[model samples]
Target: VIRGFSNSRNPEKTIRAYIQMLKTGFSPDHMTYPFLLKSLSRLLNRKLGGCLHSSVVKTGFVWDLFICNSLLHMYGTFRDRASARKLFDEMPFKNLVSWNSILDGYAKCGDVVSARQVFDDMNERDVVSWSSMVDGYVKSGEYNEALEIFDQMMSVSSSKANEVTMVSVLCACAHLGALNRGKKVHRYILDEHLPLTVILQTSLIDMYAKCGSIGDAWGVFCRASVKESDVLMWNAMIGGLASHGFIRESLQLFHKMQESEIDPDEITFLCLLAACSHGGLVKEAWHLFASLKESRAEPTSEHYACMVDVLSRAGLVKDAYDFISEMPIKPSGSMLGALLNGCINHGNLELAETVGKKLIELQPHNDGRYVGLANVYAINKRFGAARSMREAMEKKGVKKIAGHSIIELDGTPHRFIAHDKTHFDSEKIYALLHLLGTWMDLNVNNDDSDDYHCVCS
Candidate 1:
């Protein structure tokens, strides 16, 4: 009963049953304590888990492998690395499971650096050990590091990568926008006959979409069994189409999804609303927002912010401001920031000031808040106010992050700052750039329809 309840959704029942057993003067044995400790870990009841640890010690089950493993899992889930490490070191005997448990704790708690240390110290490893580090690096936004680890898993370790490991690799590829590398991953999955699970298919769709291969994304989407397509798969495809400006196609897919009885989650509606926003369909966005209110998924702060973006993007700054005024929840920084952007584009200096200050108060450390307000002041011919905004930002110790763009060429990323000439290929790069700029200037204002740089706008 303890093990059953521990594995069930309501793990608290396990704890209650154990307490009843104790009150009835029944002593739980080694077998019982493992399940009980598992329940505590699932519930993340820190104090209760500590009490159970003491109980385990008193009952002489602390050395029990299963119980100790459960305790390590609980500590890892709580991100209490210190406790996990201490118990791990104190273990009279340790197995691979024990080592993996501690490594998992370090990684889950956002200490991938320490997790790597434990991983390196291991004399032997399985796919789980390798996958953990790759997944950890992926979670930490160390995409390049993740890719390097995966390469090593394939080459150095000669370890066969599994579906879960491939997922993280694909995710890293998607983020890096490495279309060639992503394509290689896709081929590997097919070559290995790795089951094209919903998650794997969704990752492929996202990777192709972000890598500017929407047609490839569409191909994958079209070939998938529509009956077996999950909501996440649907969301990924719809989002991909929407992002690529296939707004009508995305809407059409949404209708098809409804016809198939696939319930639209919050992300689905957000995708639709964003498509409408980008397509400048203000009326359609309003209708979609109204539909969201009627759907099972309630609008979150992000949904509300997207709606504000729709209004602001369409140059309806005043309407967006009124929408904020009537919102049930307080305006988030992003929502107000959208309104502020609308104010800038529509030349509504007065409201921009109010929104700017509100944003600053809400997020005092955000450097963009000061820069945005300063830009507005400069635009409004208030030079002194613009200068004062910068001064205030400096007084608050806010520093604007340096802006740069990373472009991947020939499978290598080259980062460039504005007016930077530090790259080894700077001379040739600048020569070509100069020629392109001169050609564009020559083509500008041309009446020919074939001209690429015609400045009709």
Candidate 2:
């Protein structure tokens, strides 16, 4: 009964059943604990999991490998790495499952650095360990590192990479625009003639789309062959098409998806809404945005922000204002900033000022909103307004947050800040930027696009 309940994806029911078991005096044993922990992990019930940990310790079975492994898994699910590491350190014996659980915890926590360190330390690694690390790197958005690991693992052991490894590698390659790497992986699958499961096929299509090779993406999609694919597969194709400026095709596919009886999820609408935004289809975007409820999807803060962005980009300043005013959920800082940015882009100082104030109310510590408002004033030649904003920030003890972008060279990431003098090549980079600025000033003057440089409006 505990196993049955734990296996259930409904977290509330799972937790309830476990509590019932405890009430009945069926002290959860080693076999019982993993399921309870798993359920707690699935529900992200950290408090309940901590209670369970105490129960295990009181039972004097904290050293049991299976229970410890389950505890590690629970910690991993919630990214409680400190607890997971302590548990790992105290394990009487470490097995493949044990190591994998800890590695999975680090990976899911977005600490790929720690996960890779664990992978390197493990004396005996099975396919699960390698696959977990690869998956972690992919989720961490380190596609190049994921690919490198895949290569190294293959060289060490000739075991064919599994669907999990392939998925991460494909996703990473697509994100990095490594068309050649994507093509090579696709061909490897073809040459080896690995069974094209639904999962693998979806990854293949997504890879092609992300790599900007729509032709290849379509070929994989056509080969899906099933009369009805999963909604996620449809979403991938739709999103991919929309990504490359094929907004009409994306909408057509959405229509076909409905006709084929594949029910859309919240993610589907999010993608569709984004496509509408990029293509300036304000009417269609509004229709689908309002239709989310009918599809049994609630509008998250992200969905609301996307709508604001879409309306703003299309220059529907009044409509965008109304949309925010009537938003079902409280406007988040990002959503308000999106509107403020759009106002800045369209030279609507009034709207920018209004939205900028709301944004400051929502996020007091954030310096970005203040900077954005100042930039809008600068664009409008309202230098006094801009100066007042700066003064207000100074009075409030708010400092402008330094901007930084990261670059990776030779497998090492380097961070650069505006006018930074910290990098090894700082002198050279600064000189180059200065030279470029001088060239731009010499050849181009007072371009309106400069106002729209990073402003969404």
1-457, model 1: which lDDT tens digit per residue?
8889999999999999999999999999989988887888888899998999999999888899888998998999888999999999999988888888998898888789999999999988888888888988988988889989888889878578888898898888878888888888899999999899888899899989988899999999998998889999999999999999999999999999999999999999999999998999899899989999998999999899999999998999989999999999999989999999989888888989989989999999899999999998899899999999999999999999879877778655567998889998888788878877998788755765664542311
TM-score of each: 0.91, 0.79
What total of clashing residue pairs does each candidate reach? 0, 2
TM-score for predicted model 1 compared with the true structure: 0.91
What clash pairs does model 2 have? 342-457, 345-457
Q: What is the C-alpha lDDT of each candidate?
A: 0.90, 0.84
Q: Please write out the lDDT profile of model 2 over residues 357-411, one tens digit for every residue.
A: 8887888778887888888888888899889888888899999878886654443
Candidate maximizing lDDT: 1
lDDT value, residue 333 of candidate 1: 89
Runs in model 1 deviating more than 4 A are 23-26, 421-428, 434-457
